[model samples]
Target: MSKRIQVTFTKEQWSMIEKFRGILGESDAELIRNIVLIWLSEKSIITTKIKKEMDDENGNRN
Candidate 1:
């Protein structure tokens, strides 16, 4: 099942979101979901790289 979430943003933030939505032709939900998914993927890559670097520094690898 999917969960629903509520997000709060300032007027300026809402304005930007609206502009992007109009330009991209995506609904608010779709835009938010896409942004979050992309952010997660990028974060995961950065985290993996950091962990690998730390492991190498400690001479540990599997």
Candidate 2:
């Protein structure tokens, strides 16, 4: 039901996460999750879902 991913941040990146988490009151994992989701949402797996529905309606193969 859930996945745990491990990441190794560079010194500068770890510092940034600490700074970000301090303000957000979240762990580094939560902070990274939000950041990545926001980025992915702009060009994400959702696109495949949308395309699938459209093709189903139009009977087109892709």
Candidate 3:
């Protein structure tokens, strides 16, 4: 199963995406999907690191 999301962008933001899409040869949806996936992956890594650091500070090393 999959989920759907709706996002809104300013005209300038969209124009930048359109220019980048032309260079990458991706549709708007495809570009947004890739961007979201990459962001989520990076966010997960950062969150994990922060949690580990907090655990270490609390002397909960594992």
Candidate 4:
């Protein structure tokens, strides 16, 4: 079973989403989901890089 979610967006936000959805020929939900997934993946990469940098800095201090 799929869970349902309710989100509220401002007029400008909705307008941007609609424009992208129309250009991509995707549903609102699909566009939103893709954006969310992409953002999450990017954040994960950033976090991993930060951790690695921290580890390298700590190792150099030894």
Report lDDT (CA) for all predictions: 0.78, 0.76, 0.78, 0.75
Total backbone clashes of candidate 2, pairs 3 or more residues apart or in separate chains: 0
Off by over 4 Å in 4: 22-25, 45-62
- Candidate 3 — worst ten consecutive residues by lDDT sum? 16-25
- Residue range 1-62, candidate 1, lDDT tens digits: 59889999899988877876855458888888776766776778547787788789899985
TM-score for candidate 1, please give it: 0.56
Clashes within 3 Å, all models in order: 0, 0, 0, 0
Model 3 — TM-score against the truth?
0.51
Q: Lowest summed lDDT over 10 consecutive residues: which window, candidate 2?
A: 16-25
On lDDT, the stronger of 3 and 4 is: 3
Per-prediction TM-score to the true structure, in the order listed: 0.56, 0.55, 0.51, 0.57
Give candidate 3's total backbone clashes. 0
Best model per TM-score: 4
Query: Between the candidate structures 2 and 4, which one is better when assessed by lDDT?
Result: 2
* Displacement of the residue 52 alpha carbon in candidate 4, Å: 20
Supply candidate 3's per-residue lDDT for 10.
Answer: 100
Better candidate number, 1 or 4, judged by lDDT: 1
lDDT of 1 at 39: 79
Candidate 3 lDDT (Cα, whole model)?
Answer: 0.78
